[model samples]
Each structure stands twice: as structure tokens, then as C-alpha cells.
Target: MPGRIDARLQELGLTLPVAAKPIANYVPTVRTGNLLVVSGQVPMRDGVIAYTGKLGAGVGMDDAQAAAQLCLVNVLAQAKAALDGDLDRVVRVVRLGGFIACLPEFTAMAMAMNGASDLAVAVFGEAGRHARSTIGVPALPGDAAVEVEAIFEVA
Candidate 1:
């Protein structure tokens, strides 16, 4: 039988992609005690960056938000892999770190990050209400519009 988290994902029509491999030297996730830390994930789909460019330049608000949501999806993929494919092992969403690639004048970082936050709560309920940090950056790996990383407390 599918776990609660898996059922929730299906109910929401969200399908996590395969966990992405590290592009650099670091592993995708590291577990120390009950804490699982997921490295930053960009908006990659089918092995390619799905969203690119700075937010205030060519990317619109909706696309930037979608990019943020996709980043979270990737983060969840890594977490699922680390937990033996059982998302129900997650106890709490400790924190989320978001980086938005945007022009210097852009100041909608919070709005963009809401994409991930909303989805997190949707997927994990109260456990997904987490502390978060969102910042605007000049660029990110693969020139992705957004990147998200997370720390999860697991069983």
C-alpha cells in the first residue's frame, strides 16, 4: 500500500521525478542522526533545466514560482531516495533555503519562495510548516531561475 505522503502526492497530482545526481563533488543528501539535509536543487525536468534566466529579466512571476515549486519537487525526490522511498519517514520539515536568480532590482523573493512553501504544506500538512530563508542571487547553477534546499527530520 502507498504511504500517506504518497497518497497525498497522488491526490495532488504531483509526481516526483527521479532523484537527480550531483553535478559536482557533493552527494545529494546527507543524514546525521535524525536530520537529513538535501542539497540545493534547481528546476530540472527530464535531465535538463526547465527554467532559466533571471526573474526580473525574462522570467515572469508565475514561471519563477513554478521554478521554485519544481526545485522543491527535486528536493523531495532526493529525500525519498535517502529514506528508502518512504516519504512517510519524514517527521518534520526543519527548514528550507531558497535562492532566486533575479535582477538586482527585483524584490519578490518571498512571493517566489511561496511556491515551494505552499506545496510543502500541501504534501506534509503541519509537518511541512517550516522555517525558511529566501534570497535573491545574480545567478545559480545551470542559470536556473530558482534553487531550493531543505533539512528534514525523519524517523
Candidate 2:
């Protein structure tokens, strides 16, 4: 069965915010074949960037995790928007990629990414669990602690 992403979000005490319009030239999501490629998402709440800074430098690990979690929330919001409010169309989380802006030695990128991974699995069961790569980067937009992008297979 396709996942009940909306119900799962509510179960987690979360309500996805409206998807944000792209700030630049790119679209928020793209569709090709049965796949939907969601663009990189930041920790945005309402219409503003919620968390900003570098991990292990300007932001703590806990806050980084929260920031990553918020990015996932935006991913879901974008997905719903792409599908016109029908989240049931998502079949699986195909892949995930995250960039963590961090100090030279910080190695907690994957740990922060766990917030998104945990949400995926909780929402989609086994299908939401997928390949992921989380790597430390020198900088991200708004100097956010973390940013995440997702690829999903639609039903």
C-alpha cells in the first residue's frame, strides 16, 4: 500500500507547512517518469528560514538535528504540494542526500540526518527507508546547520 504520510505526520505531532516557492530559478520539485526529485530543503517555518548556522561551529548537535528535522518537514510539504495535496501517491522514498555545514573536523552529519531518516521510516514503513548520503560541507545557504533533498517513487 502507498504510505499514509499525512496521518503519520499527525501521529508524530507534526503538521506539514505549506510548500515554499523557489527562491531562485529552479522549481521546488521535478517529475520524470515515476520519480519526483525534490530540491534541497532548508529548515523553513512559515515563510522564513527557521535555523541558520554551521554545525559544530555556530550550531550545537541538538539544534542541528532539529534543523535537519525541519528540512524533512519541508520536504514533505513540497511533496504534498507537488501532488496537489495527495500524499498517498508516494510509493517509496527512493534516496536522500544531505549536506551539513560544519567545522573542518565535525563528523556528525549522518547523526543529524537521522532525523529525516527516522521520519521517513515512521511514515512509509520499509519503503521510506532508503539509501542516503550525508556529508559535511563547507557552507550551505543561509549558513544553515543542515539541508536535505529527497527522491521519491510515486504510485
Q: Which has the greatest TM-score?
A: 1
> Per-residue alpha-carbon lDDT of model 1 for 51-117, expressed as tens digits?
9999889999999889999999999999999999999999999999999999999999999999999
Residue 62, model 2: Cα distance from true site in angstroms: 1.3
Predicted candidate 2: what Cα RMSD to the true structure?
A: 2.1
Displacement of the residue 10 alpha carbon in candidate 1, Å: 0.5
Q: Model 2: which ten-residue window has the lowest total lDDT? A: 1-10
Off by over 4 Å in 1: none
List TM-score per model, in order.
0.99, 0.94
lDDT tens digits, residue span 23-102, model 2: 89999999999999999999988777778878877788778888888998899899999998888899999999999888
Candidate with best lDDT? 1
Instruction: State how far residue 102 of model 2 sits from its true place (Å).
Output: 0.2
How many clashing residue pairs are found in candidate 1? 0
CA lDDT of each prediction against the hidden true structure: 0.96, 0.87
